[model samples]
Target: MNRTSFRGKGKRVEFPFREAFWMSLEQIRKRLKRSIILVGSIALGISLLTHLEMTNVILATYMSSMGSTMEAYQFWLIIVSLFVCGIGLINANLIAIYERYREIGTMKCLGAMDQHVMKLFLIESLIFGAVGGVLGFSFGTITAIASSSVQLGINALSFTPLEAILRYLAISTGLSVLLSVISTMYPALRAARLNPVEALRHNI
Candidate 1:
C-alpha cells in the first residue's frame, strides 16, 4: 500500500475549518481590549435587562398586591437596556470589521474562501456571546438581589421565587446569546464580501 497514493487520493481539501478556527482565536486575541469591551457591554445590557424583567415578572405574578407601581420601572428598564445593548453590540462587531480589513485581505489572498472568512467571524461572535451570557446572567442576578435587598430592607432576596429566578436566568442567557449573534451578522457578512484586492489596499 503506497502511502503517497492514499495521501493524494482525497477530493480537493476544501473546508477551511481548522484555519478558520485558529484565525478566529487570533482575531480575538489581537483585539482583546475591543473584545472585552464588547463582551462587557453585552453582559451589562443582558444582566440589567434580565434582572428588571425577572423582577417585573415576580412582582406582577406573585406579589401584585404590594409592588404594582415598581413594576413600571422594571418594564421600562427592559426595553431601554436591550435597545442600547443591541446598538453597542452591532457597533462593536462593525468596528472589528474595520480594524481587521488587512487581516481579512491577507487570508483571502492566501487562498481562504469567503465562507471561511464568514465562519471565522461568526465563531468569534458566538464565543463572545456564550461568555457574555454566562457572565451577564450572574451579574444581573446579583444586582437584582442587591437592589431587592435595598428595597425590602435586607430581606429582599429572601422572598424571591426560586422557580422564577431559575427561569429568568435561562431565558436571559439564551436571549443574550441570540441577540449577540444577530447583531454580529451584518458586519460578518460585510467582512466576508470584501474584495481581496481592495481589502489589501484598504488602510485602517
Candidate 2:
C-alpha cells in the first residue's frame, strides 16, 4: 500500500505513522494540563476497578471463598464508574477539539487528511491510556495491599499469589487502554470531519 503524503510548501511530505506518533507526543506535552486531566480520569477509573478486583482476589486467597453478593455489588459500582469516566473522557476530547479549532484548520488547510487527524488523536489517547493504566494499577495495587494488610496483618501479602496479582494487573491495564480509545472515538471522528474554513473561523 502507498503511504499517505501531505502537501507542504509545494513539496509532498510523507505523514507516516511514526511522524503522527511523535506529533501526538508533542501535543500531549504542549497540552500538559489537559493531558494530565485525561490521564487522571483514566487512572481514577482504572484504579477503582483494580482496587475492587485486587481486594476480591486477596480475600478469596485468604478465605478460600468468594463473596458473590459483594462482588456483584462492586461490579455494578465499577460499571457505573467506568460509564462516568467514559463520559468525562468524551467531554474532554470535545473540548480539546474546540480549543484546537484553529490548529486543526491550519493543518487541514496545509493538506492534512481526515485519517491523519484521527490517527493523531487516537495515538494521543493510546499514550494517555497506557500511562494512566500503569499509574492506576500501581496505585490500586498498593491501596489493596495496604488495606489487606490492615485486615490480615501482613499475612495477606505473604499469601497473595504473585501470578494472580500480575494477571490482574495486565487485565486492568489493558482494560484502561481499551476504555480510553473507545471513549475518544466519537470526538476524534468529529475533529477529523471538521470543515477547515469553519474551524478556522470558529472562536474558542
Candidate 3:
C-alpha cells in the first residue's frame, strides 16, 4: 500500500498489487461458493483441453502413422471448449459484479478508483485461473499417461519427451490466466464505470 501524493492535488492514491492480492483473496474467501464454481468451470475446461493435447502428443509420438484428420478434429474441439469456457467466465464475472455493487460503491466512496476495482477482479481471476489450470493440467497429464500406458505399454510413458510435457504445462497455465483476464475485461469495465450512487442503490 504505497501512496504517492501529487503537488496541490491532494493524495493520488494507487492500490498496490500486494494489497490487491490480499483483498482479492479475502473476496474469494467470502464468496466461497461462487469462487468454487468459477474455479471448477475453469478447471473442467482446461482439463479437457490438456487431455486432448496430451493424448494427441502421446499418439503422435508413439504412433507417427496417425493422420492429420485427428489433429484437425482436436483443433476444432479445443477451440469450441475454450470459447465455451470464456463465455462462462464472462457470465460469472457479470453476476459477481452485480452481487458486489454495494461493495464497489463503498470502495469508490473511500477513494478507490476504476483501476483499483478492475485490478481486484483481475487478480482474483488470475488466482483462480492459475489454481484451476495447474489442477487440470495435473489431472489431464495423469489420465493421458495412464490411458496411453494401457494402450501403448509402459514404454510409452518412458519415451514421452519431458520437454514437450513441460512446455505444454506452461502453455496450459498461461492460457488459463490469459483467458480468465480477457473474459473479465467487460465485467470489470462495467463495474468500474458504475456511478457510486447508482451502484449503492443497486438492489442485488
Give a tens-digit lDDT track for model 3, residues 95-123. Answer: 99999999888888778888888888899
Candidate 2 off by > 4 Å: 1-14, 67-70
In candidate 3, what residue range of length 10 has the lowest lDDT sum?
Answer: 1-10
Error of 3 at 115 (Å): 1.0
Order of all candidates by lDDT, from best down to worst?
A: 2, 3, 1
Which residue pairs show collisions in model 1?
Answer: none
Alpha-carbon local distance difference test for all models: 0.74, 0.86, 0.83
Q: Which stretches of candidate 3 lie over 4 Å from their true place?
A: 1-11, 67-70
Give a tens-digit lDDT track for model 2, residues 1-204.
Answer: 122246455565446887788778878888999999999999999999888888777888888666513467788999999999999999999999899998889888878978888988999999999999999988888888889988898787875679877887788779988999999999999999999999999987
TM-score of each prediction: 0.81, 0.91, 0.89
Instruction: Work out how many backbone clashes candidate 2 has.
Output: 0
